[model samples]
Target: MKRTIKATFMAAMVGMSALGAEAADYKQNPFTLVYDGAIAKNEPGKVNIHPVTYRLNGLNIAANVYTPANYDPAKKYPAVVVAHPNGGVKEQVAGLYAQRLAEQGYITVAADAAYQGASEGQPRNVDKPANRIEDIHGMADFISQYAGVDQQRLGLLGICGGGGYSLAAAQTDKRFKALATLSMFNSGRVRRNGYVDSQLETILQRLQQASAARAQESAGGEVLYAGDANLTDEQIAKLPFALYRQGYEYYWKTYAHPNSTFKYTMSSLLDLMRFDATNQIELIDKPLLMIAGSKADSLYMSKEAFPKASGTQDKELFLLDGATHIETYWVPEYVDAAMGKLTTFYARTL
Candidate 1:
């Protein structure tokens, strides 16, 4: 078993290294907010995009809502709320998925979690699990009453860290008729266990550090952060895990955005240390679909969490063959595979 695990991990690492060496550069038009795949403008009488804001838990949340071609206010349309990945904003993969879903005749909304992206908050980059779950709920709340959305047909799609929060949110919200996730990264598990459970021995020490960071915050001392460093190519290649190494390549090199960052307040770990995405997961009685890359190192997270959702009989675990953890974010073929499955699942359920 140990040998198999080691080999699987090494294979994933080597695959990501090849990906990192590719010369693909992501360039965007700042004026139009266009992203990968040449997403066209929201021309009149065609599919349109709307930027919106609303107050949630006393904080102003920023979000982008997309409506299908020739949208009519008099007609009701099914809606999906998309949750962005950790260290990701609404303008990246979440927006891509939202735009695709809108093209399929569903009204979709993707939002930046409070304190992250263009949203309003203090002491930015505080990545608390509870705040993330609330962001999902807040998206549902706003979109349910939007111009032509049918509240009864509400659905959700969360990617990476957002996926874990979506699971936690859907466990009780019930407002979401269907729930889906792509390349789900269990944030709490990774934070507590250190990626692939390699830091088990340091758990107590990390928790102590987190506690001290909290104390510093309470005393108005200098703020402390974690995982907020720049890495060179050599440094990145030397990282122990493929996820972290490729993650740096993705966020820093290819899809770099000023607001998107990997740093988070160390004090936030107080809540994260105890949070588990699979805790009370059985409470999700709605239809569920969890998608991951067949060759992704993070695939184990989805596999582990899928069976714990015992309350729902309507569930599926899909793997996009030949794709890795980060490739599904922008790779056309993999994105198409994921979108095809999502379209079918949401159409059937919602």
Candidate 2:
């Protein structure tokens, strides 16, 4: 009884109470968000952001346009459409990269995924493979019509899961002059096959649970978690999985709004099983840049896609020596290399 009481006391010290529809303090979990990442909007140059909506596969998508600091609004500039990672927003890495690329003299527009963000969709945060791919093509059309954008010189950059979606998009959309993916994740393959082929044991079980959850949803039950974290030490030890730390130190801690905590229905993985980014990589003929960190577990996904790409001469794969997946998203040294390569690629391709 003494030992039991001691364990309870220790647990209480680290336990946190979560309020619904708000930011979660994850430090207690050691792998979750404890603080916030609130960054002031500083568009270095003549950055004009216009909030717009465009139709994507049946969903009305949200997008933000960044015109360069040097933007005259009177002259056309090369344009890049930046896609966010899975479960991310236009205000995250995609937005930062978009704004910076615009500051570097390109017209950059970053868009949120259909249901999860400040966009229109039903049953929010539903991760559908086809919908995501169609959203990319729709984004191309949207950015091409912006006042200072040159549609013919259009390029697309996808980060994390978005990178894979970009590959799916480029397979059919010929308008994308160049393509780039950062820390690209093969969501579909990972979902169906497990990360690095390690967790196949649970695919069937997970699928079964997802099916049951779908039925419950049809019965009008609110979506919730079946196997998510409860801030237990055991949970933290299990995270930092698949090149992702269980936490968001660099992005969320430095750029998150005090009140913004985004989450998805726990069962969204059901559809994720179908979203493979490398199914037809060989179909993409544009200049392709696949950038990843040598240390990332996801690096293999890019390496796999590179060799299968049809545009061997038009493609390049760059690995940052000691960085991890998230580090490349906003870490200065990593971001610089990414921006530098992007600048050069767009200048030549666009």
Candidate 3:
């Protein structure tokens, strides 16, 4: 078991190295989007995509704003800010949901988180909770000022790890009137305790390694990273967790994007190890909707976090029967079902 774990980490590092060797051309696609049914070109009478960039904490955040068909800036419209999964770009699942919500007559914006995707940051792919939460707030800030947006009607949808951060952000940032999470993965819990508490015994050891990595950085030593891998089909299939196995196929295969990568600086674990999405979850007093696949190996995350949101009386937990964690990202039937719930939820709440 130890050997297998070591091999997995090594493979991830190899994959990250290869990914870093190539420069990501955000314009590779016509609209720089990788999802299916993405807009090839904007038309006058359809849900149109507008590529946008705005300053967030001195960093340029790359985002896409989708306007509903026949959308007139002269008229007010509800808006939703979609946050992508960890290691995901704005052009993947987030863009898909943004486009779908726009078709539902709501303006939606999806942005690449700082230090990941097309956004500006150093030591790329720094997966810190504070930064991730701030990205959501930044999205809300940008969208609130957009034409035709009703600030009072703002809603939020966070997928995977973003969902956890959204929970943290909405706790104190009450600008969001409604909040929702899909396949929420608690990055802090997983990092500190390992997936499903599998690494509970190594908590101190990992922290020591992170501390050493930070010390090395402070001394101008070689920078180290974690979570990079180049696993083969066999390795991926052998992964113990359904979330990791299917996540490999989704991010590295079917929905691959140049800007998306799993690696983060080893020192980031210092901050990540201490963060918890549910630490102050009760602060979220707004209406909340938490959705997850009944069969998802990671479903426990949402199940655990949902009940902690005691500040809101208006909350619901919806399950997608037979869907896995990754399937909820792109599977047609599951996506449709989730969109239905989201549309209805936003309409009623926002």
- Shift in Å, residue 130, candidate 1: 0.6
lDDT of 2 by residue, 1-350 (tens): 32232222211111111111144333332212222231234344556566778887677787878777767767989999898776567766787788778767888888877776777887776666777787788888888887878778899998877888899899879999899998887777766666665557777976887778787787889775322223344433344342433233332344343322334444665776656787877888889998888877678888998888875478899988776676676566777888888888888999
TM-score of 2: 0.81
Q: In model 3, what are the clashing residue pairs, if there are any?
A: 11-229, 11-230, 12-228, 12-229, 13-228, 13-229
The digit string of per-residue lDDT tens for model 1 on 12-113 reads 321221254343334435323434753555687777888899999999999999999999989999999999888888877788899999999999999999
Q: Each model's TM-score, in the order given? A: 0.92, 0.81, 0.93
Total backbone collisions, model 1: 0
State the lDDT at 37 in candidate 2: 33
Residue 171 of model 1 has an lDDT of 94
Cand. 3 Cα-lDDT: 0.84
Residue 192 in candidate 3, Cα distance off native in Å: 0.5
Best by lDDT: 3
True-structure Cα RMSD, model 2: 7.8
What is candidate 3's TM-score against the reference?
0.93
Give the 10-residue window scoring lowest on summed lDDT in candidate 1. 9-18
Clashes of each: 0, 8, 6
lDDT of each: 0.82, 0.67, 0.84
